[model samples]
Each structure stands twice: as C-alpha cells, then as structure tokens.
Target: MTLRIALRPAPLLLRFILPRPSLLLHQLPTRRAGHGPGQRVIHYMGHQAGATQPPTPHKTIHFCSQCAGPVDLKFVSSEDRWRHICSACSHVHYLNPRNVVGCIVEHEDQVLLCRRGIQPQLGKWTVPAGYMELQESTAEGAARETLEEAGAAVEIVAPYVHFDIPGIGQAYLLFRARLAPPFTFAAQAPESLETRLFPLEDIPWDELAFSAVSLALRYYVEDRRSQSWRMHHGVIRKQAGAGPNDPGSFKLTDYMGLPLGAERIQTQA
Candidate 1:
C-alpha cells in the first residue's frame, strides 16, 4: 500500500490598490503572542522560511521608571498579556515594541549601503537605520539615521516597508529616499566602517547584516524589476532551535499600493 500527504494551495496575495486605513486595519488579522499559561500563537497566511516559533519578549523589565521601584511580571486582564507592574507605586510599565527607522537611499540606478563597525554583525552591509529618537517623526528619524551612518542627506520619497520582528520587539520602518542636492556621502566612523553604492544586481546578499535588511532589499529589487512599487508589510522570525548567532529568515505577509493622494514628507536635516 502507498500513502501520500495532501497539500493545500498557497493563499492568494490580497492586494488593495487604494485601501482605506480603517478598512485595512479591520481586514488584516492581528498577530499576537503571549508568555502566560496556555499561550496561543497566530500565523498569517504567507510564505514561511522555515518552522515558526512563538513570539518572545525582546527583554525583561526589572524596575519601574516612574518611581525607581522594583517591578514584577503579571498578566494584565485588560491587555490580555503580561506586563511589568510596580509593586511600590502601583504604576504599570508597559513594554511595547520599539520603532527602528531607516531609509533606502537611491541615486541613479544604485542604492547606498553601509558596512558596520559595531560588534553585532560587524563588517556586514546594511541600510542606514537605528532606533528612533524622541520628539521626531518616523520619516525624520529615518533621514537622520541615514545621514549619521552614511553621511548622506536624502529626500524622503515615500514609506516603503514596515517589517516587524516580534521576537526582538522591533518594528523596522524603512522608506524609499533619494539623495538630496549635491548627492554626496561618506562612511561615518564607529557606526559604519565603509559606505558605498551598489547596483541592484550587485547587492551583497550573503553579507547583509540582518534579515530585515535582506528582506527590504529583496522587495525593493522586485518592485523595481516589475516597475510596480508598493508598500510592504511583513515579519522576520527565527526558526525553531535557531540560536542567537544563526542567520534566520523572513516572511512576506502582505503588500499593497499606497492610497491615492498619498503625500510625501520632506526629511528634516
């Protein structure tokens, strides 16, 4: 007797040319994970790089910022997840994912990339990006990071990709940008060892610093090749049993064209 496993067809890519923000929010299912008892994991219908693992908190909070009091992890009933609650002042310290803003600095047919001088993935190439600073818009932060790391002033074109790495509590907001007037750049030290432009076909895929960078570059190349630009949303997750030193993979969960009349914001120098 012979036995075979039945496989289902992949889900169709849901595209919305000019979807309303409210409609998009309502249509997309929320992906959430919990660390409490009997946690449930939600996965979107998309291409999976490998086996998926439940989301984990990026870091543990030990003390409350409000009163400098010790905090304990407790499951909040309203939020339906665990949070660090202060035992002294009763202030709840909510841990939310951080926003990492960056830009894909484009000029002519080449894109700018920076080699890292820091410890994490040192010497690997990546787009200029870092944690968002306080009192700045996402676009402004992206541009600021580009200048700091790549020493290039860029004009924000449009929002490009929003990729969430829930396991590390980071949401990368990458934008498509072009070099401002003068079109000059250099590698800033400490943060970057070298900065250079690479044609789309010449991108150093094997030496990319992070999964987020690799995914963003791949999507950019795909859009350019097809001459159809779109905003992308997705997640980069680590495979089961993958260690911290392992290079993980990413999943493209959704993509959509910008809504009509979308306005471009100028990057603050």
Candidate 2:
C-alpha cells in the first residue's frame, strides 16, 4: 500500500505484450455464499454482467458486425485462432476485449453505489460503471457513466484500477473521482434501480454486481486504512488445475511497465 501513483490514457492492446509474471492479481476464493433466494453461484468470473468471452460468445453470432452477411467461425489468413469471417464478403470480424469505464465517487468517508435494475445481476449493488463509447476517453466515459447511472456529477481524480477479465473479454478502468457538494444522486439510468452512499464498513460486499466491484471496494478501503494509494493493474482468470492454492489456480503477476502518461506505447515486444 505504500505506492501512490496515477496513469494516463494508453492503448489497451499494449497489455498483451507485457510479461505475465509482472502482473499482480488478487484472487477471490471460490465461494458459495448467500446470493438471496433462487440464485446459484457460478464458479468462474465473467459469467455474470453479460461479459461473455470470445470464440464462444454469450450471444449467438449469426451475422457479422462489419457486414450483414452470414458469418462462420474459421481459421483466417494462416492465423491459428479462429475468427468470425463473413461468408459472402470474406470480411474477418476480430473480437476484442471491451472496455468498461467507471468511477469510485468519493465524498468524504462515503462512496456512491448503485442498485442495478438490469440483468444479469439485477438488484445487485455496484459503483457506477458501464461500457465505454467510441471516441470518448476513459476518464470522460467514467464521468458520463457516473452521471447517467447515479445521476450524480463527479470530478475525475486519478486512475485507480485497471482490471482485466480475460474470461469475459473485457477490461475495467476505474478512477478515483470526487463528488461535488450536496452529494445528491437519483437512479436516472434505466439500468439502475437506486443509488446510495455507504460507509466503508456498511458496503454490501456479498451483493456486489461483479467481483471487480468488490475487489475495487476492498482495495479502496485498504488504501484508506493504510493512508496510501497506488494505481492497480491486474487480471482475473478462471481457476486452473485442481489444487485449491496451487500457483496455477490463481496467478498474481505484476503489471506492465507503461508509464502513467505516455502518448503511445509500443504494442510489439
């Protein structure tokens, strides 16, 4: 917790080239904790929140995004990986990780959280966050999501965490933001049912919408307790091997060495 730093916008693709052992990840023990009535806990992360993985998407792919032509999954251009290629137009559709931007809006000792009104975790609580839009910076997208979901304005502070869930094919960018005076919010977005602020102890850890949300809150609370904060970059992958505590089960690696505010980082090693 001694480290304290921030990051500037960099191309997300650069992450793949970084050494695997350098990315430190915090693992969440598989749990069967209470999730209310009629809900069965899933083993892997990224199964929830409509964050499905590639090659085998959550939604069936019948047509290509580039062209309306019928698409088929097949090896393309001597590439080992199978891709969604258009049958008529031969346009290959490359599926990449989606970027989700959001903020941890802090006002004094309280942090804002919202109750989701949508699936796949309807009624669960989370910090205001959602998919990033085209042409919008991560910070701007975070601010926009805060206003849209919680109906609260926030001043972007600094990058807090960059979580990669390869199982879901998504990356989350969370910023530490400040809420303006009055600290009022409404559940304006259709995705949110309600919004409220909670002390660190009172946060609903078990009812969080995603594991990343819980992880972020835990990190924030820990940082406050130690009076130190640093930007976090990590990944969440499916449990591997059989042993409960095996290194292969949950690998925690250090983050890539991309400087905080670089204009463009090399993607190739």
Candidate 3:
C-alpha cells in the first residue's frame, strides 16, 4: 500500500506578523518620557551610519569590576587625577602602572638575549622579560620569565635596573642573574624565536627591542668597563619629532647613576 503525504500552509497564528501602522506608532516611543522640548531624543530605529563614535576608554576599562556598573572619568581628591568611578556604586576604579620583570642572564662575560616572538617589537632582540604576576616578588618574576623565554635557569644576583616609562604606564625591574649549574639553555621557547649569548663588545645595539632593554644593557656595559656594579634608576621619555619605535626617539634620564651622553643633575642633600 502507498501512503500519500500532503503539504499545507502554516496556520494564520503561526505566520510572521507585521505590526499595524497605528500599533507601531503607539509601541515605538521615539522620545523618552518627561523630556522638555528642544532636548535630544535618541531614536533607536534611526540609521546611525557615519555617526562619530565615542573615544575608546583608556586601557579598555569601561566598567567597574565590583558592581559591573558603567564608569566615568572624574577627579578624585585623594588621587589628584581623573579616575574611573562607578556611577551606581560610587566605587573608584584605580588604574595603576604595570610592572615588567626580567633578568639579564650573564655567563662568562656574555649576556643571554632572546628574539621576541610577540609584538610591540616582534623579531627584535631583548633580555628575557614579561609582565609580573600577582603573589610573586620581582626577583621571582624575573627568574620565571628568564626560564620561560630563554629556557635558562638563573640565580638572581641583585636588582640591576629600575626603569620607568610613564608614557606607556609601565615599570621595568631588571636584575643581574648568573646561569645555574651546567650553564645551558634551550635555543628557543614559545615566546622566543631565537636565543643567543652576546659578548659585551658584540651586543647588537641597533637591533635591540625596547628602550628599557637598551638602557639597561648600556648601564651594564658602563659598569663592566669601570669594574663597578651598582643599581640604577632611570626614566625613558619620548622625545618630540620622533616615532615610538624609533631607536633615537627616547631620552633616558637617570635618577641615580649617570646616563649615557648626559650629565647628572646633583640635588642638595
């Protein structure tokens, strides 16, 4: 026996319904209630193509973490600067500079350098370094970054350089480190395209990645030449008429030791 199947149109209630013109007029409210004449009414149905968009929030932080409320920039008396404050909860969201920790691993008069596989300066050489994680000391972060990037286990000797980049809201703490026993390292890691040791006289100054790395290396070389090892503090400021990635774009101002090509300004004790 053959079975016959028949096709039928969908029921009227199940069909797509377009709103009546009068019903649309009542349902779609263009102007918000209680607004006086001459006030702007945001039309939700209007085409907003080619409209100017709002500026992006700094560091991509647009909402409060505690209450998930919309945040706006307001002057905080305690901070003495504009900070993001929650509209509903009145909570202040503090935006602070981030710390980057790393080590300058030294072995037999040579320093370990890694070619970055990531950006901001991809393919450029730098000492092993990355952002510091919470619950870890700066020295610990340095050793961990060194091991992860250059695959070398190192004993941090001392904090060598404290460099600040105010323009980018970052602080770099670089330490002098000695390679552990056996003095071996993997040629590359996940974050590094290549790794090599460069002697003091053979450092690729022009090919170095960040200003902080270059400045730290310069301090190390200067100290090595004088046979004196001391901690250094400095700030890297972007100079006018120079691009961010330009080698000569940044001016290094040393707060402790004398920086290259600049005389130290002495302050009265």
Question: Which candidate number would show the highest TM-score if scored against the true structure?
Answer: 1
- In candidate 2, what are the lDDT values of residues 1-31, reduced to their tens digit? 0122344455453223323223223532112
Model 2, stretches more than 4 Å misplaced?
Answer: 1-60, 64-67, 239-269
lDDT of each: 0.72, 0.68, 0.70
Clashes of each: 0, 7, 0
Candidate 1 accuracy as TM-score: 0.73
Error at 162, model 3, angstroms: 0.7
Residue 256 miss distance in model 2 (angstroms): 7.9
User: By lDDT, is 1 or 2 better?
Assistant: 1
TM-score of each: 0.73, 0.69, 0.70
The candidate that achieves the highest lDDT relative to the unseen native structure: 1
lDDT tens per residue, model 1, 1-269: 11122333434444322221221211332221122243333434543435343344433878889988998877554544567789899898876899999999999989999999997899999999999999887888888899999999888887888877777789999999999877999999999999999999999988988777887787788777866666667555655554322443333333333321243455443
Order by lDDT, highest first: 1, 3, 2
Q: What tens digits encode model 3's per-residue C-alpha lDDT throughout 1-269?
A: 11122323322322211222111101221212113343232223543545444344454568889999998877544434567889989898787899999999999999999998888688898999999999887877888898899988887666788978887889999988888866788746559999999999999988888878887888788777876666666567766555434765776542344223221211111
